[model samples]
Target: MRSAVVAASLAAVALGITGPAQAAPARTSAATAAAAVTSTAGGSITRSEIIERAQYWVDQGVPYSQSAYYRDPQGRTYRTDCSGMVSMSWHLTTSATTWTLPDYSTQLGSLDDLQPGDALNNVNTHVVLFVGWTDSSHSTATIMEEARPGTNARKTTYSRSYLNSNGFKPYRYDKVVESPVTVPDKGMTNVTAVGDLSGDGVGDVIAVEAATGDLYRYNGPDYVGRSARVKIGYGWDSMSDIVGVGDITGDGVADILAVDAENGNLYRYSGPDYGGRSARVQIGTGWDSMTNLTGVGDITGDGSPDLIAVEKSTGDLYRYSGPDYAGRTARVKIGSGWNIYTSLTGIGDITGDGVADILAVDTETGNLYRYSGPNYNGGTRVQIGTGWDSMTNLTGVGDITGDRVPDLLAVKASTQDLYRYSGPSFPGGSAVQIGSGW
Candidate 1:
């Protein structure tokens, strides 16, 4: 009963958000204002007081040594699961709060309707507190919670894919909320197309060819040879990895960010125009900067697009703010154990705190790390998936399973296997495997 409702609700969100309702807010300046509003809310603690409090608490370190886990009915530590950790945190923060919890099956709903304190359920497996979501498509989100198995209390990040895996089945919260879309797209396929094009906020099939310099976008509904092809860059070559979708240049339309393996050039394009070429520029200097770059999205709080590039040989990350494509702004180093073979994928909000955070996946080693903010000169980094299995592909950003904040969707790719992490709300650490083995 619980699963059936979550699947239906998310499918409805796909249809509604992508429909005509996503049009401009009656004015161009209004759109920019909307962007600003969205960006402002990206930070988890809105006020300096809360930010200071959070930092102060974290600086003191997780006080697990002084605390003991709440024993479940089975005598197991509730801290063993993600939701249990969150529940424990809530208890510690407020003397009034109790271990008695609400059923996650009923808490899922439109993200817009949720409050900061509300808890959202992810396919009934995990949970996280409500944090702000991105203005457009709510593609970006933030959550603060403890993550992983057999580990002490730690904050983690979650993305759209975490919830929407398995044909959006993983997210089953409440009944579908209805909002009429005003946009004139045909037969709901545009939602699928936009997903293919990279920024529609859902998990779709996308592939880029380095040899032919071609970009292919396909929907899960009909993935064959047919795909939207755009020739954004040149130099007779191969493309390696890609990340992010948005108006990187503050333009109203969405754009693409890709990396060229050979020259180490980071390219951005307005569109892939066959007649001519779209506006493209090379960002960053230095060896590893250009060699491997991944989009990190508005990291500097400047509202411009940002990129996190890793040196193929050193694994060091260079944060390049992109308002100035010509200069690529400032570069801040990230991560200590960087490796060339490691693949970095962007997750919305891992910490449950609203600020923009990123998830790094080590392709070679299959380890996962959640980076929260570029704060304190370099921000805070937490290692999550340092285990045997690694995750591939972030499906989308949303409360797929209905936890207040967005969760993440990951696929192994090799076997087309799907896995999910319920936000802090559903902390069982029991990753529910969905879909067929690819």
Candidate 2:
């Protein structure tokens, strides 16, 4: 009898309970659509994309069909149920019911926290995408949902009181592609590092296949739809050993800097783009003790890119200004206890003060910290955000928001979803989903 009860519960959870009949309204206001596009800092799907997809349904006069599924322009199939419409808008790998969507979302405490790409969900029943707030008090919001059977997918306004009374819970999807433009990885996996390799102003992604020691680069954010794969010597299985990538040569184009995992030797490779025959220049040895590595821009005010490294044992941070191996200055001790950091990156001019800042994520708590000044020495340490432990990798991806201040790009370890955090600082800031499915 217990086994039967368990099975029944599982079934109930799979097929969520139906909610109130959806009101088939017209498209949302232009301001609401515009807000959706610009409100989120970074995501694979912008508010505009969501509005566009939802609008496509409206234009097609797509009637809600539990038995039939809607096919996206990419030829992906999704059920026409309420949850299915959300799944399609979210670009999820597969359709999910209301009960299962919370598993892929971060719960928001109140409707006041709602953003364009966020969602309203009642775990037992219905789900809706939040487009924008309808009133100054945020008591009412404009939303898009499939509504109910026999109804066409449409946008409608709902009062917060009505939604809360019906058990609707606000949530932000874990995988948000704030920007629709993306470069699909051509069978690449285990992205160890990312940077702007092509000097195109847009950041690119780097991946290393451990089994093969093969390195691949993909133009990102504004994906040009191509990749360049090359073998970087051999025996490079340790992802942590590979360090920074930037314009190390003082050239306009970016370069790749890596530490030999086995020998602790640092090497720099010059070639702004792929398909160019380039050779590696060994910088120095004794990098085996380095726990973390980052490219600090012109710490010495020199034209070339400088470097920062952390010692694994002592949590000591060092700044190395360079012109290549012998020309590089002696290591300058900058900070200590850096070993407690799981991820570190040099965010360019985060304060908009004409100086670069260092961003670090705590290993234990996932709390984010910013070290701001001309250099790491005597810089102020400010706590940015907590609960970033889900991040597997974090790096500075230039000024993604076009705000002059640099932003951060992060990858979730479990879902491999990409996120971007923008603003003058991370404190009181939020990350929007930029890419999904690794």
Q: Pick the candidate with the highest TM-score.
A: 2
TM accuracy, model 1? 0.43
The CA lDDT of each predicted structure is 0.37, 0.57
Q: What is the C-alpha local distance difference test score of candidate 1?
A: 0.37
Cα-lDDT of candidate 2: 0.57
Instruction: Write the residue-wise lDDT of candidate 1 on 1-438 in tens digits.
Output: 000000111111111111101111222222212221111111222222222222222222233332345432122243434454444323222211112344322443465454333444553344554333312223223443333442333222233333333111212222222222121111100011112234543434344332233344543322333333333334322333344445555645445554444554656555322111345666533322333344445656776766566544444556766654443345667554454223344444445454555555543333555556653123465545453122334443334454444444454322234455554221225355543321
Each prediction's TM-score versus the true structure: 0.43, 0.51
What digit string (tens of lDDT, one per residue) describes model 2 on residues 111-165?
8887776789987777888876533334335677776654566654454544655
In candidate 2, where is summed lDDT lowest over 10 consecutive residues? 1-10
On the 0 to 100 scale, the lDDT of residue 349 in model 2 is: 61
